[model samples]
Target: MKRTQNEKILQIQNHTLVVGIDVGKDSHYARAFDNRGIELAKLLRFSNTAQGYEALDEWMRMIMEQKAKTEAIVGFEPTGHYWFTLGDHLQGKGHRLGIVNPFHVKCTRELDDNSPTKNDRKDPKTIAMLVKDGRFRDVYIPADLYSELREAVSERERLQGQLIALSNQIHRWLDIRFPEFITVFKDWGGKTAQATLKNFPTPARVMAAGAAGVLQVWQKHLQRSSLKKAERLVRAAEKSIGRTAGSEAAEAALANLLAQYDMIAGQRQRIEQLMQELLLRVPNAGKLLEIRGIGMVTAAVIISEIGDIRRFQDPRQILKMAGLSLKENSSGKHRGKTTINKRGRRRLREGLFQVMIPMLAINAEFRAMHQKNLTRLVNPLNKMQSVIALCGKLVRVIYAILTKGCLYDAEKMTNDMKRSMKAA
Candidate 1:
């Protein structure tokens, strides 16, 4: 549940103890403070292990008993994945966990001592003070299927990055050794192209093998041989201006790159398969996939990033989480330009933007909306603005479908837009 700042501040009563922890890769430092920002105990140092967590819990209980505090709220900067274990530990122990923005901690560090220097001891106090002032957000830890979905999506992204890096390296290798290779086969990853590269990568090798040799290599993998393609490759090799030195080293490099590309490609395929399985486990995810432009991967990613749609009161919250919420800079009577805040999950925002492109092509309702945004009589948004607006619309649609258990209704969507236009 989302809480107002006042409500959050009220939660930190006199009997409540706020503990701020500075998370690290090896060791963590924590300090306890009363509701009024007074230190309750000395700084506690703990290792990043089970025993260390037990010691920290013991220390917190001691502080609570000594200071006459009834409840304890632990707050900390996320500090990457290091805090995940601690957050789960605290939550499991029945302590309320609050996540303070690392940026807030950095900005507010000078508030107490007015010193720019940083250390383990000074950060916990700043985190605790932020929690006291209600400058923290409730942490959302995915459980069950949501946890599996998140992990699967993360693995897919990692494999995607590896695939891209391997692709770039392969392209660079081809550019140096077989510059004209791309002209023959636009994508070297194709079966025939890959087989040819695996067998005869260099122009010298291509010349030695000739067209028949290349065709022999390709025929082993390809169902049908293209003599014209083979002849073209041979011609390009003959006129090639590729490097002649370091032939042995270049062969090894190309072999290694191709092997890495194949391995990463297989890994990505497996990850997508896993993502598909996990998406089935998520409730109402199939309804999202029913939309024309929303593929399995896109739906899985959106569901993974925004777990448990019931937590959000409205679609606007989802938009804000994606950093698609609009911001303005108006002051006094002067109207100012508005733009997206871009302060939330970057991957989510990118996924939304990418999904819009296919949506504009495949989804009639979305295409109509895009066209209306472009050709409207008054203050028509540009192409990019239209896409951004559509992204928000898509978020609302997904939220409604998931929360209300309704399927996509094209006519209803169009009618709603018409009513909105009339209201405007």
Candidate 2:
């Protein structure tokens, strides 16, 4: 929908220009209005490109000149990547920019026009009205380093998943070729097993090499393992009337799998290096790393997700952003359970979950709280549920540390422990 910047200006108690933009994949439809809600200009469309940016700037300038002395407030929906460029460009131009929620725009659109029909021009106006009412948030644009770190870490996660899948495929190949092999060795990717597999791709090859030849390979490539383990593997290989898969096929599959594994391992190393470098630059990263289980990767994820923690007015906002907010479903007669809202940034939620896992396992206070929350009539959360609840609360702790610039309070957990004890 297009916005009327003039209508926005007319409705404002204070003199301001409201430029509502309906973001699109390749272009943007916009409307401008004055504080009195008067339409000062007709509908305009511009390409979502560099030239389009220039055009938008020229048009904004013309509107400012026509209004003479009023300040300009540009508003647009958070329309995925399409709006990012425009938002960045407008912020660069020194214009005040606010982001309207797309959900709010959809609900408000029908209220403005009950017919449910929509046009690009109409949507922008609705967005501008929402902006004029102060129902918008300023977007956070991370610094270049944080952005690069975010991309790097995200790629690392993707590669890790791929590596796992490849490893699983290798396991499946092993099962088909030698079913009893895994019973003796847990992970085929371990240094000794990888060396064993590289040397003897098939059961027949291992049997041919016997115990002495197998120990030689392990000694050459994986020096840490004792000859005893190699002898055990040789014994397992000799006893097997294992599957008769072709030697050539098994060798080719093993070679391909190892190559992919090596590539992913290299990529992961690079990602870790980048993450550590970027994390060192973030405020209080050293303090965060000092917390057990919160290493450079975890610190990087937390910092990248919560860029410029000062932007949050309070710690609760960070909790809500991470979908850690509590939601109750109580009614007149039915007293329902409370659960997490679970409707915000996924990565933030994941980061908090990851952080809480180690804490729950090792931190004395967290373990006590979890057990204390697992009673019958007074407390109802199961072990798993209690852990999730602790993770949700952990969001508040992390937020407090970031927002208030406080140290990780090993003692602060006492409050939750006391509450659970009282409930029990």
List TM-score per model, in order.
0.96, 0.84
- In model 1, which residue pairs have backbone atoms overlapping below 3 Å? none
Residue 122 of model 1 has an lDDT of 95
State in Å the error of residue 12, model 1: 1.8
In candidate 1, how many Å is residue 9 off? 1.6
lDDT of each: 0.91, 0.77
Model 1, stretches more than 4 Å misplaced? 422-424
Query: Across residues 304-332, which tens digit of lDDT does each residue of candidate 2 receive?
Result: 88777767766667767778788999989
Write one digit per residue (lDDT tens) for candidate 1, span 1-424. 6658888998899999999999999999999999889998899999999999999999999999998988899999888899999999999999999999888998999998899989999999999999999999888898888899989999999989988888888898888888999999989888888998889989999999999988888888889999899999999999998888999999999999899888888888998999999888777788888889989999889899998888988788888888999999999999898999998888789889998899999899899999999998899999999999999989988888898889999899999889978877
Per model, how many backbone clashes are there?
0, 26
